[model samples]
Target: MNRKELEQRLRQELALPYYNAKIAERDYSESEFQEMKAQLQADIEQYARDYVNESNANG
Candidate 1:
């Protein structure tokens, strides 16, 4: 996928209900929130990469 599409996908995937609850309840401090978001983004990016790799390999 292109950069734009990948970014959009990441945003959509990052909107998890568990995280939403944490944000709504003020469960984490600002730095903590940022750290969590950063990690989640990294994880999502890796997952996307893995999915693409698998698809290419299968074909």
Candidate 2:
């Protein structure tokens, strides 16, 4: 699927009660665990930067 469709699906799924638990478990892996954690950390940092930029723009 495309980005828009994928995001829409994610938004829909996130509305469910068990979304957080299952979503975290879906990334489960024994060997690639460190890589996943690093990737997720980078993703969070990038998002924070984007949010800061948007806030500065609005302010």
Top-TM-score candidate index: 1
For candidate 2, what is the lDDT? 0.50
Models 1 onward score TM values of: 0.57, 0.51
Model 2 agreement with the true structure over 1-59: per-residue lDDT tens digits: 43334334444643432223123323334344445345555766899999999999999
Best-fitting candidate, scored by lDDT: 1
Assess candidate 1 and give its lDDT. 0.58
RMSD of each: 10.0, 9.5
User: What is candidate 1's lDDT per residue for 1-59, written digit by digit as tens?
Assistant: 43333344445657753332223332344555457568878887999999999999999
Question: Candidate 1's error at 55, in angstroms?
Answer: 0.3
| Model 1 TM-score on a 0 to 1 scale | 0.57
lDDT of 1 at 38: 84
lDDT (0 to 1) per candidate: 0.58, 0.50
Candidate 1: how large is its RMSD? 10.0
